[model samples]
Target: MISQYLGIIHPLFPVPSSSVKTGFTTSISAGDKLPQIQILPLLDEVLGVHRVNNRTTHQLTVPPSADDDHAQAWEAFFPEGCINPGNKVAPMGGFGFFMKGPNDFATELGKATSTHVLFNYEVLFESEWEWRKGGKLPGIFGGAGDAAYTCTGGRQSDGKCFNLRLMWRENGKGELYAYLPLTSSNTEHLLSVPPRSIQHPDYGFSVGRGAFTFVPGRWTTIAERIKLNTIGYEDGEIEVFIDGKSVILATGLILRDSTAIESRVRGLHFQTFFGGHAPEWASPKTQRAWFTNVSGAILTDERGIHRDEL
Candidate 1:
């Protein structure tokens, strides 16, 4: 039952003064409240924040709700966004941040000792959102802290690190994008609409592609459960629920094959951007997306104790 909650109404960090032009304002001084859970004092200081281009590109601001339904939310603005197709040097729009092991909720989640995790979040694509080719969304990541980037960037997994993120295709089509050890036995369990590989051959494949579609101008709730597989076992599981509807249920996933500390759910991988390193993936114009209610918990057994404890 241990959990952590993040809401834009209570900003995670102070909004940079230079971001005023983007409609970002300092939010109220209400701290993130975690009931029945121990709060980590170094939570804010240890986060790995990486902003694309500059801090002004992303900010926490008031949401565009019709009424007073939501107080505020985090926003990422894409201004003629693209990842530079030719040389693949410049990357525009979006922001990324990671919470690694032994920091913030990661410590409470038992670092690599725990094997299962449940995460939930809400996202809202502004009415002006233009879904070009597609983009990355938030999810979980684990492995060696220095080698965390190994799970992405077309790098193949060597039974060590792994990443699980969401992807959105044209017309708001949604799917699960993951980077992990893929084998002949586990590949057969991947489930998608019509079943196709939607990624580069070097990278990972798409799961549950188009199983549920995202709609702009409204909030979409996503809940995910990740269970790590035993060493040398292909029994890992991934279940996704979109707006309370079970859209994906896949088993026999071989996320890792070693009994190392890095082969488990480490922490949140908050990454959102547009592009496939191609010109066609660019956004047509300036647009925005909002996110709120980012939370996660380590599932426990019937006696309210982590499975490892039992």
Candidate 2:
């Protein structure tokens, strides 16, 4: 019934609760968990974000808390379905924040669903293994030429340095692919890591597979530049920027005829299977960096954002 499935729950991600209650069908719940995914640090608020037919919408905020393990709100669509298809996990379409299921929930999440993953992380070196939670295989596999930790040395680029990446799902066979431009910054060079296979030697912090590395601090504004129009099909653009400088940029990047920097960009999104810099392949330095304020929309079909929007 589709090109392929990525998740089990048709998640209405980052939505706030209509009422303060833990209901799978409701956004609110009496459980411990990180604030709803749509946590806007700057707004001092939370939001419930969902999608339908691929269009994204925003809802009220679920109050904030110092907890990340919020509870599961909905009943099982199928207890039998619990054995989530790893490669394509289900997205909880509509549910209030629920109660936490168990202590090792992300472990459980890895088991029940979301196995199809491409690993990338910051460390002294990259590995040639897959990510496993509890000695069990995940639904996802990995990529090639792991981006290891730079030699405490350093790197520099001309004009500007940027971080670039590509986010794509694999075919059932588990090969690599991309559907969008992940990053297109120009200043990433100043930060140490620049475009392409080369990397910076200094130790820094990064998140979401280490592509969005920044100063050891929280980001004031996190935004992406994009336009969803072009001559061919699936035309779009995305420039990941921190503060206001662009990290990843690709013009006419998404049309049918364009080719891109694959391995380097993929390096950004690839997580670590072999624990390197961060514990268990996480960047120990990343958390020390802060992500305080947050305000970015979920644009599904917009061509571009205003200057202020970025």
TM-score per prediction, in order, is 0.75, 0.27
Query: Candidate 1: what lDDT?
Result: 0.62
lDDT of 1 by residue, 1-310 (tens): 1122222122221111121111111112212322322222222243333422343344667788823334656677766754422224554677666644234455655555577776656789987678988988888887665566568767887767888888899899888887877677666777332334454487577877877899999888776667887777777877666765556667778887764546667666777888677778887777788776555556542221212211
TM-score of 2: 0.27
Residue pair clashes in candidate 1: none
What lDDT score is found at residue 193 in candidate 2? 29
Give the number of the best model, judged by TM-score: 1
Estimate, for each residue in 122-169, the C-alpha lDDT of model 2 and write its tens digit. Answer: 111111212211010111111112321111112222111222222211
Runs of candidate 1 exceeding 4 Å displacement = 1-57, 66-69, 84-91, 100-104, 191-199, 259-262, 301-310
RMSD of 1: 9.1
